[model samples]
Target: MKSVTRSLRILEAVAQHQPVTVGELTKMFGLPKSTVQRTLVTLNEAGWLRANRKDTTRWEIGARVLAVRPAALQGSSLFAAAREPMIRLRDTLNETIHLSVPDALQSMVVVDRVDCTHAVRTFHAIGDTSPLHATATGRAILAHLPKADIDELVEHGLERFGDSTPTDDGQLRADLARVRADGYSVNRKQYRPDVCAVAAPILDEDGTPLATVAASMPESRYDEQRVPELGRLIADAAKEIAARRNGA
Candidate 1:
């Protein structure tokens, strides 16, 4: 019972100050480093807290926590919560807008979308699955996933979908790190030869990603100079969906 209580306390601390280091957690709990490390290892294995991919020294709440909690926007209501924002974004950018959630299989699945009317545009069905390391929408959610989950994907190896896909483990890791820092991800004809995209995570109150929002366009219409702007717009739209969920 004492061990269980200590584990909960450590989890609480991680939830309060996520991406925290062992030294910080030890200091916060006034416990020995060994004790904290042992508890952290247990929690991490159980999917309670995950190490940060960028800096393994730090830890954050894991994907398991998100799995136990219902998605911020889920079921039929998810479309209701996301439709307006998706349409608004598509209108603003004239690009295909996507709303997707990471599924039990650790793959991202599109739930809703607003298609661009352009002669040359990207499109996907409502239930299409995307590769975690190849698609912007997938990476956006993956960037916020627990390190243990990320490691599982890495161990499985990133498969190549197109010429631009990052097949190298180190390269993909670096890309995920960049996504974490930028709060978004971009794909340059990675998932499909003609498609370019930018995506952002929709996070819950605990900072766990519940889903992702993405804007995809034809390579001919995508401009490298506009990536940052496009990414920001997508991120803002995703946040609107998350805010609606939180308010409800």
Candidate 2:
């Protein structure tokens, strides 16, 4: 409770008075300088805060925040960033591929998408939220989330989208643990009754899960024999995205 309060306070402070200094935050929040300094320093190191070039003494949100903007997806800005990778992955897998992110408290949506070559293939909603406990994209993002976020999400329980969607914590935890351990995630008909997908989290330099890249296929393409291969392929795609993102 105490830690949550402190982090929230820090985030609120930053959000409210974005370009603020450590001294100013300490004074406004009535927190000890030591405490305020430590929090701001950590945020800065995590790329959540940056020193203003106009005045090195002040800090504000950094480029990492800018990169996630849906508004930036217009024309050259959004497509230039994600189109090539989305195209290449779709081509290689011969399946629908998506670059998706959280849309609401419970759903994930595709901001960018590529259709598969097959006449009959899984389809995804470009601006829709896949289920929290069903899609590989959600699991991949959840795997890297802070413990509080995961626990809070599970307390809400899984929203059933299919017969296989897990509504229990034990199984979700096990699945998420495997995702973290293997650097990727896999889902088998957990969302749509006949759709399966694999996903991996794209990380920034600080190792924060920025977003997810995933491939959707029909249930017919799934089997233990092919699951591992799919996991590897999705992970490779995520790594490629991460490399390009970091470079940009």
Candidate 3:
């Protein structure tokens, strides 16, 4: 534990003076050169620091630490709560299953997912972010938010990420209004080309939106006659998650 704390101290010093040298680290931490070098080696091995071979003998943060974040986050941590339902839904539809929470922006944030059986399955790996105006998941949560919150997100401006992305404010408002009347949102290749999604709001007992759930599939395989069945699957799965969340 002492060694761990000491290594963290060295890391802190390195961060404070990033791209610093071993000598500089030794001086900053007032530790022996051997201790600094050993700590640097350990941190580098663990992907916490990078050793630059060029001038200044520079050591910087490694891609390991930055690219792959530790699974330490503060929140309701509800992903675990939905695992069973996600699996059930994945088997039920043989399509990709996704769950996300609302971000500060109008965008939907992917937090968890279950891949489909096919190699050609939709791949929305966890943590992928989706646009508010172009994704079923985003519209699901947005439809349930109050007018003021929706207005705040709209004021931030819509950013286009795909060919069919909706940046027009008036059209987006109309679409959201339709979502309110229909009780679900359907995004047809509006986010990714040739990709489509159906999403439903997961509500708490008080009828407030807590999160959104989506079932995504390829547009080529879409059956207009079967869309209602797909919507039923998504809506039912979302309700199961909501009940567990609200203890209803």
Candidate 4:
């Protein structure tokens, strides 16, 4: 009973401070490092937590954790606010539209999506996760985060998903600057070889990104000449979702 209680507490702590190291959890719980490590390993085996890909010493919430709470997300304020906007965006662009929220600073989790009619459109499951530096929805959220947080994420080392992923620190920073200035982000075969997306952050009243709204399609259908138009449309959709979220 005591071990179960300790494991639950450790899981809660990891959820709150994900991509956290076992040493950090040990210090937080005032438990021996070995005890914390064992609990973490147990949780990892059970699919409640997963080690960060870049730094195996750190742990983050896993797919199973997300899978169990999907109903909660479906009933949440963000989902309610984003649903209409996502559908409208998909209809307008004839491309799959996704609503994603940041999973700590590690990745973006797709919470909902509206599919386009095209047979070859891009697709993402509700619990699908994407690297923050390699996807339009992820970069849109990152661009609105505090500088310190961005610096920490960069220091953690950006994993390369493909040739177009922004792994260079300086280059990523520059790209984020453009995202901020333009109020949107773009991805062209960055995270997925055949996916292209344009997205914008949905900011809360405090101007922090609560989620991102993206229009995604197959790379074969991506039109570079339409980037500015797509950026504007997606940015407007994000603003509408934000407004709806705030009860405006």
Candidate 5:
């Protein structure tokens, strides 16, 4: 109860002060800096708050927090619908499966996931964010969004995470073009050297992507020869999910 109370207070503080800093929170609450820091981290991880990219020390309400209204709940509802399918995919492939939605133009946040039981696997927590230009899951959705939106995201700058990550706008645009043509995106150690992933977008009735489903594994476990086949499996799964969702 005390922990919950403390977290609530932090949320209240953040709501009252937009783009506030840790020092400001600590001072205002008269709490230990470490306690405030931990609370802030927890809130940020839960998608209630986001630290500024330009100034990591400052924090503000996250997109998820800001999107608590009815319309945004569509994604939350999508998470519920995707649960069984994600689990089935994990069971079938014996690999970590992630369901993510666009959190911002430049990132996708994991809403749910099924972790692989393998001794070596790519691990990510729910609510974790991945860069659009460097992740299969992010690109899967990005490829389906408006070109103007994609251009704006690129204009913001692509932060490279790995040697294979695309940093140039032209190169990233070309990559997105391929994703659209192929109906799936593949990340070859672009986000993490040890992890590779394949992903497909779950489209709405209007053909706009609402979310993505991804399968990730250690590079060692990834069979290069099976990449196309695996991509096809995920793409088919995504389409089936979209069909079911539309029917519902």
Candidate 6:
């Protein structure tokens, strides 16, 4: 009984502070290092947790956890609110549309998606995760985060995923500033070499980001001249989703 309770508690903690290290979990629970490690290993084996892809020493939520949950949005209001707008955006642009929410400040997890009919469209599994510094979906949310939170994420180090990924703190901050000013973000093969995306955030009543909606496609299909139009469309969709979610 005690073991089960501890395991559940540890799982909740991991969900709250994902990409967390075992040493950090140990400190959080005030448990022995060995005990925390054993629990983490057990959870990993059970498919409730997995090591972070960028840093294997840290743990994050796994696909099975999302798979077993009802509708996989963790009961988020954003999912229901964004569904229609996401579909409309996909139909309008003929590109894949994704809805992602922050996993703490570590990464953005795809909670929902509307797929386009194009054979070469970009795709992300519903539970897939992407770095907050390197993807348009992530940058949209990151741009709205509190400065202290952004500072903490930057201090943790941004791992470069591709040539276009912003690794330097100054560059990343500049990119985020552009996102704030433009009301959207653009990713040009930043996270995935073949993909390009434009995204905007769904903000809560307090103007904090609740989720992001992105229109993604293969780099070969991206049109630089259409970026402003695409950005405006995505931003409008995001605003509509936010309004619906907030019952406004």
| Cα lDDT of model 2 by residue, 157-206, tens digit | 77787777878899889989999998888888887788878888877678
Which candidate number would show the highest TM-score if scored against the true structure? 6
**Which pairs clash (backbone N, Cα, C closer than 3 Å) in model 4?**
none
lDDT of each: 0.85, 0.76, 0.77, 0.90, 0.84, 0.90
lDDT of 4 by residue, 156-240 (tens): 9999989989998998999999999999999999999888999999999999998899999888999999999999999999999
TM-score (all chains, Cα) for each model: 0.68, 0.67, 0.69, 0.80, 0.74, 0.82
User: Please, what are the lDDT tens digits per residue for candidate 5 over residues 43-148?
Assistant: 9999999988888889988877644532354466576677788788888899999888887674787767789899878888666777888999888988988989
Query: On residues 1-248, what C-alpha lDDT tens digit does candidate 6 reach at each position?
Result: 38899999999899888889999998898999999999999989999999999999999988788665326565667778888988999889999998888888877888788899988778788778789999998889889888999899999999999988999899999999999999999999999988999999999999989889899999899999999999999999999999999898
Error of 5 at 62 (Å): 9.4
In candidate 1, which residue ranges exceed 4 Å CA deviation? 1-75
Candidate achieving higher lDDT, 1 or 6: 6
Ordered from best to worst TM-score, the candidate numbers read: 6, 4, 5, 3, 1, 2
lDDT of 4 at 220: 93
Please list the residue runs of candidate 6 whose C-alpha ends up more than 4 Å from where it truly belongs after superposition.
9-46, 49-62, 66-75
Candidate 3's C-alpha runs over 4 A off are 1-77
Worst 10 residues of 3 by lDDT: 66-75
Measured by TM-score, how close is model 3 to the native structure? 0.69
Q: Residues 12-130, candidate 3: write the lDDT tens digits.
A: 77766888989988887788899889999999989889876575378986655433321332135456557789899999888898887766553566777889887776787555667
lDDT of 1 by residue, 89-122 (tens): 9999998898888774356877777898888788
What's model 4's lDDT at 234? 95
Error of 3 at 40 (Å): 16
